[model samples]
Target: MLTLTHRDMLTLKHRDMLAFGHRDMLAFGHMAMLTLTHRDMLTLTQRDMLAFGHMAMLTLRHLDMLTLTHRDMLAFGHMDMLTRTGTC
Candidate 1:
C-alpha cells in the first residue's frame, strides 16, 4: 500500500487546487448542488482541505473577514459530504 505524509498531501492538495481552474470551480459548484461521484468526492475533499488550511492561516491574521468565509466553506463542505454519504 502507498502512504502519503502530511507534506506530500499538502503538495498534492496544492497541485489539485492549481489544476482546478475557474470553469472547474463552476462545475464543482454545480456538482455539489446536485450529486457527486466517488471521484468528485475525492476531488472535493482535497479542495476543501486546501481551502480550510488557507482559511485557518487567514483567520489568524484577519479574523473577522476570513472567518465568515471559512465557516461558509465548512458548512457547505460538510453539508455536501454528509448528504452524499448518507450521513447527514
Candidate 2:
C-alpha cells in the first residue's frame, strides 16, 4: 500500500535491497537501476524456471518415482543375495 521513491531506494546497500523488491527494479528506466540489466531476458528466465520446476513436480507426482526406485533397489538386493548363494 506504500511505495519507495528512487531516492529512498538508491540509499539502500545491495544487501539491504531485498526488503524493497529490488530484484524487480531491473527496468527502472534509469540506467543505474539494472543489475544484470537484461530486463526482458531476466523476466523470461524466471518464468521459464518456475514453469520447468512445476512440470518436474507434476511428472514426479504422476510417476511416483521414489516408490519405483525403492522397488528397484529391493530387487537389486535380492538378486545380489541370490548371486552370492548361487541360487540363480
Q: Pick the candidate with the highest TM-score.
A: 1
- Candidate 1, residues 1-88: lDDT per residue as tens digits? 1222233222222212223212222122222222222222222222232222211211111111111111122333432332121221
Model 2 weakest lDDT span, ten residues long: 46-55
Alpha carbon RMSD to native, model 1: 15.6
Q: Tell me the whole-model lDDT of each prediction, alpha carbons only.
A: 0.23, 0.19
Candidate 2 local lDDT, 18-79, one digit each (tens) = 22122222222111222221111222111111111111111112212211111111111211
What C-alpha lDDT, on a 0 to 100 scale, does residue 26 get in candidate 1? 19
Clashes of each: 0, 0
